[model samples]
Target: MTPAVTPAARPRQVRRTLPTEEARDLLELVRELIHKEIVPVADEEEAAARFPREVFRRLSGTGLLSLPYPQEYGGGGQPYQVYLQMLEELAAARLTVGLGVSVHTLACHALAGYGTAGQRAAHLPAMLGGGTLGAYCLSEPASGSDAAALRTRAVRDGDDWVLTGTKAWITHGGIADFYTVFARTGAPGPRGITAFLVPGDAPGLTAAAPERKMGLGGSPTAQVHLDGVRVPDARRIGAEGEGFAIALAALDSGRLGIAACAVGLAQAALDTALWFTAQRHQFGRPVLDFQGLRFMLADMATQIEAGRALYLAAARLRDTGEPFSRQAAMAKLFCTDTAMRVTTDAVQLMGGYGCTSDFPAERYMREAKVLQIVEGTNQIQRMVIARDLAGPPGR
Candidate 1:
C-alpha cells in the first residue's frame, strides 16, 4: 500500500520577471489590494449578482484606474507589460474588476490617441485620473462582428452632431461616466464612420436593463439607446470619417487586455485545483500522487504559461512601436481557447466539488466562455490572421 502524499501546505507562487523596481513595487501593491479587499468579497458579490461600483471608485483612488497612460494627465505612467501584470493580479482575485479596467482603457483610447490638444486638456485629466469611468460603443443591434455594417447615424447640425441609433452588448453601459461612440456620418461603409465622446448624462442617451448572463453578473452589460443625442463638434475624437481606424486601433490593444484576463482567470482556477489536489486524499494516498491526475495539472500549468507568454509578447511589440495587430489577434485567439480548456480541466480535477459555487472552478469556466466571444469572436480573430497571411483582396 502507498503512503499518502500531500500537496505542499502553501499555495505555489508564480515567478515573474519585473523590468524595474517601481514595477515590482506596483505589482506588490496590487496583490496586497486584491488580498485585503477583493478576494474576501468576490464570491458574495458574484453570488448575489450585484455590481461593485464602490470597488472601482476605490481603485481610482489607488492610482490603479489608469496605470498605463501618461502620468502628466493623472495616469500612473507604467509600461504595458507592468500594467498587464497588475491586471492579472486583479483578475485572479475578481475577474469582473480586471475586465472592467480593460474596457475603461478601451473607452479612453480614441481620445487619448487622436483627440486635439483642447480635447485632451479638457477631458483626459478626469478620465486618466480614474474619477470617471468610460465605455466603448461600437456594436449595434444589427452589427456584432460585422462592425462595418453598423447603421447608427450621426448628422452634423451646425455646431453639434445629432446621433440616433442603439448600441448593443456594451460593457459599463449604464454605469460609465462617459461613452466613446462610433456612428455613421457619411457614406454606408467603414469610411463613413466617426467616433464621438458623449457624456453619460446626455439628454437623449439611455441604457436598457442589464443583460442576464451565464457569469460575471457582477458587471453590467446592456444596450444603449441614442434618441437623437447631440454632441458638439469638439467632442469628436478624430476627423469626420476615422471611427473605423480608431476602433481597430483600440481593439489591437483591447485584445491583449482580454488575453491577459483569460490567463489570470486560468491561473486562479489552476491554483484552486492545485490546492485541492494536495489537500484531498484517496485510496491510501493523495489524489495528486496519482500520475494521471498529476499530468492533467501539469498540462493546465503549461497551457497557462504559454498563453501568458503570447500576450506579453504582443504587449512588448506595442511598446516598441511595432505593428502588433497580427500578433495581438493570434494571442487573443490562442489565449482565450486555452482559458476555456484550463478552466474545464480544473473543474474536472476537483470532481463533484468543482461544479458547485462552493468552489470557483465552475464560475471560472463560465467566465472563460465569454472571453472567446468578446473583442471580436475567436472566429473573427482567425479571419484577421488569415487575411494578413493571404494578403489583401487579390494580392
Candidate 2:
C-alpha cells in the first residue's frame, strides 16, 4: 500500500532534482538566443499584432521545438522538466512565442499518446522536425471551461467522418499545418467526444478573423471553422469517447507548460524592475538604495523562486511517471497566482513607466493575467485540488 502524505509533506515528496549539464547548457543557449533574437523584435510585432512565423521557423531550427518527444520520432527526447525550463526561458523573452510552443506541445501530446502506429509514422516526423506546426481544437463559442458542452459534430459516413463546427480561441488557427480536433461522436457530454488529426489544407476548413486581445498580440488567436471537413477513419486518434480523457491528460501536462510560462514572465518583470531600480535615481541615490523598495524587490524574487520550485516539482513528477495530475494542478494554481502578484508589484515599482509600452512591464502584467485564465482557470484549479483532497468525486 502507498504511504499517506499530508499536504505539508507533499512538497518534500515532490521536490525537483538538479538539471543535467547538457540541459543547463541548452537552456543558457536558449536564453542568449531569446535576448538577441526575440526581444529585439518583440515590440514591433506587438504593435503590428502579427504572428512571427519566421521567428518560429528560426526556433524550430534551434531544435528547441521538439525537446520532449522520442528520438525515434524525430524528437530531441528531453525530459518534461528540461522541456518546461526551455519554455520558461522562451516565455521570459516573449509570451507569444511561449504560447506558440505550448500549443504545439499539446498537439504533439495527442499524436504521441493516442495516434495509431501508422498515424505516428506518417505525422510525428514532420511535426517534431518543425516542418509541420499544429493546433488543438476543443473549445467552441459555447464551450469555454465546459469543454464537454462543445457543439462540434463528427458524423461517420462509410470510410470517412465529416466534421462541422467552429472552434474558438485556437492558438495557431490560421498558421498551423495540422490540427488535433475533438468532435461529438456519442451522446452529449465528454463521453461522446472523439479526437481526429486534420491536415491544415483539408477542404472546407478555414479560419475566422483573429480575435482582438488584451495581450499576446503577436500570437494570432482565432476561430477555426469546419464545414463538412472529411477525414479518413485512419485519422481517428483513439477509440470513440476517448477524446475527453486524452484532452484532460494532455492538459494535465499542458498546465505545467503554462506554469513555466508564468514563471518566465514573472522573472522578466522582476529582472526589468531590478535593472531599472538600480539605474533610476531617487532622493540623490538609486531606488535600490531605499530599504522600502528593496524589500518589495526581495518579495518579488522570493515569489518567483517559489513559483519555479512548484512547477519544476510537478514537471519532475510527470517525467518520473508518477501520479502528477494533482501536483500539476497545484503548480498551475500557485505559479500563475504568484506571477500575477510579482508582475503587479513590478509595475508598481516602476510607477508611471510601468503603465506604458516604453518598457515591457505593462505587457508582462497583461500576459500574466491571461496565464491564470488559460489551461483551466484558477477557480477551476482550486476545485480540482479540493476534489483530489476529497478523494474520488462520488466517494
What digit string (tens of lDDT, one per residue) describes model 1 on residues 1-395? 32233321222456777899988888778877877788877887988987778878888888898888888777888888888878877887888998999999999999989999889889988987757899999998889999998999999999999999999999999989999999999999999999999999999999999999998999899999999999999999899899999999999999999998999999998998888877678897778899999899999999999999999998999988999999999999998999899999989988887887777889999999999999999999999999989976688
lDDT of 2: 0.85
lDDT of 2 by residue, 189-303 (tens): 8899999999999999999988888888888889999999999999999999999999999999999999999988888888878766776776778887899999999998898
Kindly state the number of residue pairs that clash in model 1.
0
Query: Model 1: how far is 367 from its true place, Å?
Result: 0.3
What are the per-model C-alpha RMSD values against the true structure?
2.8, 8.3
Each prediction's whole-model lDDT (CA): 0.89, 0.85
Candidate 1 residue 36 C-alpha distance from true site, Å = 1.0
